[model samples]
Target chain A: MNGVKRLSAPLNEKQLLNLRAGDEVSIYGVIYTARDAAHKRIYEIIKNGDKMPFDPEGQIIYYVGPTPPRPGRVIGSAGPTTSCRMDKYTPLLLEKGIKAVIGKGKRSEEIKKSFIENGAVYLVALGGAGALLSRHIVRAEVIAFEDLGPEAIYKMEVEGFPAFVCYDLYGRDLFEEGIKKYRKE
Target chain B: MREVHWERISKAVAELFKKINYYLNEDVYNALKKSLEIEESPVGKRVLCQLLENAEIAAEERIPLCQDTGIAVVFISLGQEVIIKGKNLEDAVNIGVAEGYSEGYLRKSVVRDPIKRINTGNNTPAIIHTEIIPGDKIKITVSAKGGGSENMSAMSMLSPAAGSEGIIDFVLETVKRAGPNPCPPIIVGVGVGGNFELAPLLAKKALLRPLNEKNEDEFWRNMEDILLQKINSLGIGPQGFGGRITALKVSIETFPCHIASLPVAVNIDCHCHRHWTIEI
Candidate 1:
């Protein structure tokens, strides 16, 4: 519980500059969702200089592909997918002014360096905690690439969406530093 | 010979798939609980707690524990004295899988073709493995294997000279390389001594074993224990946040292989570890 930070999304430089690798944070706001298929499409749009489905400036993109929601629910089990798969498309999104990225697992060194150059942050959510995470997302609607099924881009409003900064602007990696303290071999 | 109706197979398959995806197996749940007790890092503990709560929520709500409800991997053991009636056995299972995925609100992850990548929509045509056993009863095991962990699966056809030391090193290398990608505190299923294809199958089958149960052979049991410690010592931890418990269990299954080959495979299952069995 100690030292956990609370911040709202669509963040600014002041909010991000203070964050460091390994810092726990609970985010509150709307976050755009995109996984492998959606990222590929989004990359194509950016490469063609077409307007993005949603403005990337000062926003967060969560890598996820959730299940179909039941009759009464706002969303289905929606947790972060692996982030490494999106490394190729990230720099373009970052260049467009996105503030943060959320997903599970390690990102490549190149992506970490990208974060530094772009002054952005990488937040790692608890992977496989879909059921728990869904409770935090109050609303979700597909905004683009509707034919992609689960991979469609979704606009979601979340509260207390928990994550930890895995990479910050300084290029410190939580995965590398976190393992150093615990590895015996 | 007992006649087992195909409709019964389809019904059981549908129900079992739904049940396993929504409610994680008891053995897997207990392993996570125990791991939580031993897990030291605050971040690791937090992740474990989230997983524990996620399982509880999924069970109570009748929703999947994870969104990637997985490709249905059905292991069917048919009695030598039984005959299947109604539809073809494989068709019946596929029907059941499609119905279950749709009805249960599970994600339809299977696609028609690997390269073309169009969703099969109903999650149909399960990966079915059948075998003949001596008894008169039909036993079915359904495991919803998520892609995250399945992507981390590894195999190597090491030379006979590589021996135990070589195999252990491979296991470590694979797990370390997998890191957080497979979702940590993973169940490591290792297959040793089978032929090229069978080795990987054995690895996947090894995951179905109860989490607490050690290998029946003392030699392999020792190997499991040694591997578990070595893997945990790597410090990947829960979701690779870094802690004491990187893997909840290491299960090894072996079979006789050719003298010239030492085939091995590692199939990683995430902490969700959704699988169930039924006999009818």
Candidate 2:
């Protein structure tokens, strides 16, 4: 098990603060999937003063656009998209009470700052390991923006979904620290 | 003259996309295995292991290796002495791509227009690059490029005087800025000396070559080795978690150009390397 930390969805402030960068986490329970288009729409809903599709309080948002599953599978190759594309929209979501976000790649300095202020965390999944990650997603159902196809938000039930803490509430960044530590000249 | 049907092209294109998406190429697979033995960071080692396992699971289960099955980029070489029976070359390729994505259950990632941003649903209208050669055979290569890595690609027009050092610096800077965004342990394809358009195409083509293949010319061969070393030393490591194996390979392609132009382009490929070729 390599001391892998077990976590559940809708993480609390204490749990978010306890995590450290680079800690391998096995997450369970509900995590919502949203990528570029859905984020835009969610942001619009907020801008228009409409009721949010789902409450964002203490919820984990996974940035993904999964493939269509084969007949027997619940989901297809599901993995993290780049985190940077959602950078412009993240602060608003954080303010709306998103506790954690999961994806691959770098987040902006402002996004990191937002994480600290909101007491949220940033985690990343294995970017291209969709087949491996799909095994942990036991259920998936589109909850909004079905028109967006793969880009729609899906409420999913996950079990032992693998991720690593990339940004914690203290404003530490795994990507920045890891690169600096290993960079030679 | 030889006669080839468009349907065969479509069938091959469809099969090729499916095969490439579901199965990791043997060279890339072996490289990851080798990297596992040498990666120093514990998390980097774990990531390498997970990638190998992902490939196995993808192949065994017959699902795509990644959700971003990628925009279809096809390169075709048609023999000058050949005739198509069913459809035009471009139409045949796009039809094949549409069939493959829909039938194989690959994600439809392409937007109808760059600005409008509407999904085409079937993943049609593949980006096709074609050339006419001497023989009567048709050769095609299909690559699925993920948006995450593709968006990080860059190009620049340097002064002819900037020379090789300038290129090294540009490529290094691009990698540094990309950090983990392109999904490190990336494959960097560099093109030098072509015009604005050709330079990027040449860079994209460099990615289609096998990871184990080195450039034929001695200068380019050494350049590849140097870039590989420099990139790995960046220590972005696998998925930018940080470690010794940031880049698995760096391939450069070049062409003669105007003395005044020194255009260079770097196209980054994620570790998936979803490319396959067929000859007919």
Candidate 3:
């Protein structure tokens, strides 16, 4: 097992890469939720020099669009969406002080390069493990784009939300590394 | 012609939507469990465990197996001798979908338009495909395809000269390019020898096959084994953490095509592979 360090809500790139795909992570802190629509809006904000709704510094963004919760529930099955869809907007967020991204799937080369240059890291939560992920989110509220429905930007407070480091600041990728180690000769 | 009751059909469809969202099919569940035993990498084994646990929790809690909840894709095989009664068949199906999605708390992932995309609110107007079969009994299959894996599906028309080797190459290329994006340890559904559009449909239909079941035809059976071996060799492993089991299974369905054309379509289902069938 790799060494695990429990840090505060906002984690740095070095701290993020310490995670591997199967490694269990307990993320305690603030995280933001954004899907395709919200991503486009965030990009527009960056392009127009507008202030983002939440502070990006040391923040982690989760790429998810959750189901509407039932009565007396915080939120419905909340799992990560494919991360590659956010590739275009990710570099921009990292440039603005965002330290980490949490989602599924491999990111593009451009996004990975930005991760190295800007000291950002990518984390992955199990894609279909919605109920499992939902157990981590203690609280959630829409911070922006309410009309976007599930795609709305929501600030979520999670306790011990599990994730793995898929991409590290050093440009090493778990997807690539795992394949090399396990592929038959 | 015998009349079919829309209300009954609607209720059955609604139940199907709910049951599939809450329950992972037995074949898929068993396959995931088996994957853990054969998976070589430690990380891969962990991922498989989480998936298995997730399936159990989702089923027990009656929650969606995945957050995306997927765009509702229904395949209906109707009996030609059956006639519809009461409400319009299409409307009933749509209502069933809306109610099922709302009642089950499945996410409404569908949008109004692809380019000008707007949330449809209730996940209504399911993408329903209907075909008239020879039997009097209506068979319906529901597959909740998550966006991540759906986005990775691809289709191509190869020259008739390409043959099985060419088809295998295309499938491998598509999986490699998809990488971790499609959610690794995927089930690859390959449809070969049909027309352009039919090829994709056949590919998707192939996914409904039992996970461990082999094709009856020896040629297709060999193709399935070869593809499965090649895919796992890619080392995409569970959730792309890199492992021996890049794919849990590779299922192929084929039809005779024109002499000049060879159509191939690949549909990828994530490990969740949420699906169920109901007949009423």
Candidate 4:
């Protein structure tokens, strides 16, 4: 793993290229939250030639459905959910110019290939580290699908949100290396 | 007959859910701490450290440990000598669950049906498992089982002669396949020799045992050690980043089975095993 790098959201090509699998990053700026249900909604919206709740271009979508914020708090224990469930709709979002994604667990081989092809990256926040990650979220507002409750689309303003690059633009995958390094015969 | 009011049952369930969701069980917390001390991979250690910090934050701040507060799984050991008064037992527990999730601001993650997906709005209709025992008091254990780990669990009907080796292999294969998805330093709860359906139940129940507690039976305790060693050797590590501490503990609970069947089930519990028990 490389030293920690700092990057802004809606990452540019240069910023994306700088990321390699296993590199730690502290991301700042706007990110959006959408889990399985929200992704399905977004996919249908695109299929029907309709607009998404937010601009798809140059945006990072975090696979998350945060617990509702308590009174006077910006958010609850907000952390990334498992990302594998989003495999079906992720490539479609990438094709639409989505820049990066954040979640835990490995993506499918096909999704990783798309990340390389589309110059996108997948970030991993430690799973089950929800309360710790919430400290990084400065603000959260439901931008769409409020009926889905916690599954609604949230416009999140984050500062120094910590994650590691698990899948990168160049087709590197940290999870693969992780198993190889430690698996005993 | 000892009479227990439905309101008391509901209140107990609600309070248990609220407490367990926000607080990490001391056994699980200590196991994670011990795992952190010996985790070989730097990344794995870092992840474990974050999990530790998350637990502290959740407990101190009174927030749900993870956003997925989970489908409520309640294990009730009812005393045969006691009589429950009020709404039926299941209804009372569901009412308590609804109150707990709503009042405590925990996420309501239960869907109405597996085939027809619809959010239940309030986390209700808990997966309740009840057993009658000879006592005047009842024991209830509530576990907030997260979906990620629960999805990784598996059951198999091994050949009758497959024996202990077969059981070991099944548990190993399950953890290997689970990889990072179940959130390692997982607790492997293995149920061997029970009937097909009961095997999984036994496996889930095994998870309620404290990490530091060994199986009361020597043979099973040794089996737990072997399985745990083999699992950690797979290098799944913390959060599946690769390390020597893939599992914090392996608990096996068994029951006599029919001669024709050797059913084995593996139920994986994430490091954030949110479960608590109270005697009422």
User: Is candidate 1 or 3 superior in TM-score?
Assistant: 1
The collision pairs in model 3 are: A178-B242
RMSD of each: 1.1, 1.0, 1.6, 1.0
TM-score of chain A of 1: 0.97
Worst 10 residues of 4 chain B by lDDT: B108-117
lDDT tens readout by residue for model 3, B118-181? 8788897788899999867788888888888988999999998888889989999999888888
lDDT of 4 at B43: 91
Error of 4 at B85 (Å): 1.7
lDDT of 2 by residue, B208-234 (tens): 889989999999999999989999899
- Pick by TM-score: 1 or 2, better one: 2
**Over the stretch B102-135, how does candidate 4's per-residue lDDT look in tens digits?**
9899998977888766899998889999999998
Cα error, residue A23 of model 3, in Å, equals 5.1
lDDT of 1 by residue, A1-185 (tens): 35888878899999998898889998899999999989999899999989999989899999999999999999998888889999999999999999899999998878888899998999998888888889999999999999999999999999998889998888788888778778887
lDDT of 1 by residue, B109-133 (tens): 8889999999888998799999999
Task: List the DockQ of the predictions in order.
Answer: 0.78, 0.79, 0.82, 0.81
Q: Which parts of model 3 have CA positions greater than 4 angstroms off?
A: A12-23
Whose lDDT is greatest here? Answer: 2
Per-candidate Cα lDDT values, in order, are: 0.91, 0.92, 0.85, 0.90
Q: List runs of model 1 lying over 4 Å from the truth.
A: none
